[model samples]
Target: MAKDLQERNHLVRWGILIGLSFFSLATIFILIIDFEILRNPDITQDHHFRIALFILVIYFTIYATSGFIRYLARYLNNRYLTRFTALPKLSSYQESFTRSYFPNKPYEHIVILLHGFTASPQEFQFLIKHLEANNIPYISPKIIGFGISSTHLLSLAHRHDWYRVAIEKYDLASSLANKVSIVGHSMGGILATFVAMHRPVHQLILSGPGLHSAPSDLKYKRLLSLPIISSLYIRIVPYLPKPIRKGRQTTSDTLDQTHTGTMFQYLAIPINCVKEVFSAQDDVDITKTQSDQLTIVYGKHDLTVNMSALFQQLDHHNTPYNKMSFNNSAHNVLEDYDKEYCCQYIINLLKNPQKTNPISKLKKQSTTQVQADA
Candidate 1:
């Protein structure tokens, strides 16, 4: 299956390259013909060629303008962020530090929180409060590249570094507590799976896992997954605008509107960083995963991951897992619209690890809904 996926990805990459090559060649040929027509007024009678040239020129104009804006945005962002790159003290960035919460009672059970890509431990702030109030011991570790202002450092870090840091944090939690559960969001969900594969996890809760990207992100995913094309592509355009929320839905609930403190990369992210995410995801095989220890919490409005593809993979693997869905939430389920219900649901699961039926513990909400099986 892995080999087949790889072959398909290769074909997609080559197809994209071929399509772009043909478009470029056609544009050049049209330009040459137009120049000849201008030099010889009698040849200007070719109306079909003139129409084609006009269309291609308009397309090129839009593409070039978009590319220029992306490159300029990357340049300014990098220049601003480079100031923090030299700072020896990570403490300067409060969000960058790993957060650990040890209750008054001795640690019998502990939960490890992993934040998503381009996001910090701050994403779990509300959830952390709930965990603390309930006297639940938890540790939220900051991934190596995240929580810092420097996109350059983020680009430098690879998937291996992310996997290593997560495993180390898991090992630390294992030493402190008899039982440990992993609660991961987005990219963290991917890391959590890898950690579970390496060690024994009491429970695994994934919030909008990055196993499969949304339909909108599929083109970018395919383009960046290629080795040679991605490397060259990044050099030309290092960053692109991050997808924005449509309708009235907003991320204001998840992040503070007044605070300049960077909890998430709202503007844009390095293309190389995106490539690293795809690399980590490629290492994960859903068929080999142990679904018995897994529970998925996702949002119906999520645009970051393809829910249809995720469901297909789960059903095909016959991976039995407790699935919860929130209509009001997007990718950030922790502090999204259904946050109150989401946090309570997670707290109940952590408190009663033995209870496999998630629906039985939490009261069903009319506004938000849950699906029992995957």
Candidate 2:
């Protein structure tokens, strides 16, 4: 399964190269043909040069704008967003959260949750409530470098810390419950896959899974996946590690496409962190997924991750998966308008763990059709 996904990733990389090639060829063809026909002999050589320069400037201007918005989003996330923390470390905050999500009761099933990148355990509160309402205990660990309480993110090295800590939480949950369910959102969705592959999980749920990546934000990743460029970068990255490559720290105030959790997320990633995410994703394999039951809820309009690519992953595994999507939601599906709907979906899945929901043959199956209006 991992091999197939790797091949698909390569296809995406080559597709970009192919598109650039065709665009360049077309541009050259137009300039040569147009030059011969119009042949502005009266126009000075500098006049033609200036026109080309102006076109280049416009193209680069738009590119730069898009890049700026992306970075600005990251900046705002690192600065303004509220961080939600949970775990043994923040034992002090437990008294407050307990009155809300953690209703004191005997536990049944244990739910282990992982939140999105630059997010905190708070993302799990809604789902956590559903679990507690059903007499289930849960442990939603804060990925080390995230949350408002964290201070070492800039100095932290890689995702290994996250994966290891997450596994530890899963083990703790396993000891506490008769059965275990794992849930992840966005970046956590990717990490959840790693645990589900090797651990004993009764069910697996991914909200806004990040398996599918947007081309524009992921363009820098292509440098590592591409052939000769990868070799050159490999030889050059050591001297220019994460800190230096991270450049200057900065923040932004808003994101163009709004969402409930956007403000809190760190939109900007250090170059090293980008490589870490890619490396982690580069290792995902469906064959390794050990769970007998899987449920994936994606937003039809999610901008952070591509749903089509993710759907293709499970479809290729031919593994039975319950695929659900909400029309009004975006990348942060877990925090969007349909959050209640998301909670209900988990409850339903847990109630019927053996039932299978197949991936759509033509497109993703919508929740309205699958669950039938609550």
Candidate 3:
């Protein structure tokens, strides 16, 4: 089976190479000179031809730059950031570790925190502190490709491994507590949903759940998964200053500009990991949730996820779920603005399950109205 897969991948690679080559050539030809319109008379005499040629040159340059952006980013990351950012020297604390704030107590509520891509359990520091203060026992498991600075190691982790880790943690929490509540951030949201669907989950909280995406964006993502393209997209973010170095800037300076304090390219997302996230979404059935079991919180200004698409999915599945949208917030909800309010909201919801909003309530009310009319 491995051999067959290998052969199939080989064929696919050849096909992609051929396709890209043809497309690039066609684009260049169309941009440079419309063969039907431009008859190659004299270069100097034909002003239109020269203008078209100049535009074509500019277009090619931009195209080449985009394709090679990966190599340039890799060079910059290795030179300016990785060495002095203090990442290769991972401290014990930087790695994954779990502790119960109030140990040795019969706990009825347990929270499982599944972190996001290329991030560690530390992502949930704020939430963990809250859980501790509330005397709630929780476990944060390390996904295989994370909690470390080794890029190659992180790149190798898959979605199955992430799910396995979550499942193991769930079992541990289940044995210790009467109810297991899952809180997932970003990619972690996908895992949380999976647990809620398959396991005996008491409550689920998703922070910027990265579940569904638009079909066009998904197609673009799949294209990025290709070898040459994926490599570039993985290592490059918008903030990285290309080949341009400021006056006497140290590695720390570069790190500061990119907001990568004390960590080596934390934003350097892995393609395999991304693929795994989308895979989890595709593999899981997220159409509906059990009564009062789910609460999804996302920033209204979240650039990564489509809130409309998510709401549409839930409505399509006839799923009843509670949702909250925060203003002036980005992807990470626990670390962003209004986090405290969200934390209190979660605490209140867990403490007072009766107040939880169920989408089905409106439907039930509508049904009652119809019966009265009939």
Strongest candidate by TM-score: 1
Off by over 4 Å in 3: 1-105, 214-219, 224-265, 288-292, 356-374
Following a full C-alpha superposition, what root-mean-square deviation does model 3 have from the true structure?
16.5
lDDT of each: 0.74, 0.64, 0.63
Return the top candidate by lDDT: 1
Per residue, candidate 2 scores C-alpha lDDT tens digits across 1-374 of 43333432243344445445555654665455545324666665645664775577557545655555566556544443234343322222323332223334345677788998666888776677877877656787878777754334733547676676677677667656668888888779888888887687788888887776766457767776777876676566622221211121222111213344344555444445666677778766644788867888877666667778777877897878877887666666666666657676776677666543333321233455466755
User: Candidate 1: misplaced stretches above 4 Å?
Assistant: 1-106, 245-263, 290-292, 354-374
Clash count list over all predictions: 1, 5, 0
Tens digits of per-residue lDDT, candidate 1, 131-234, equal 99899999999898888867778868878778878877987897789888999999999998888776788879999999987676778889987879988999
Sort by TM-score, best first: 1, 2, 3
lDDT for residue 269 in candidate 2, whole number 0-100: 47
| Predicted candidate 3 versus true structure: per-residue lDDT over 1-374, tens digit per residue | 43333433333344446546655775567566645346656433466765766676556655655555555555544554433434121211212323334354377878888887667887777777777877878898877778875667756766666766777688678767878888888778888877666677887888888787534347746765587876666666312221112331322212123333543335545556666666677766666444247778876656555668788888887787888766645566566655555565666566665575443443355468669989
Q: Each model's TM-score, in the order given? A: 0.65, 0.58, 0.57
**Residue 199, model 3: Cα distance from true site in angstroms:** 0.4
Clashes of 1: 1
All models, RMSD in angstroms: 14.6, 18.8, 16.5
User: Clash number for model 3?
Assistant: 0
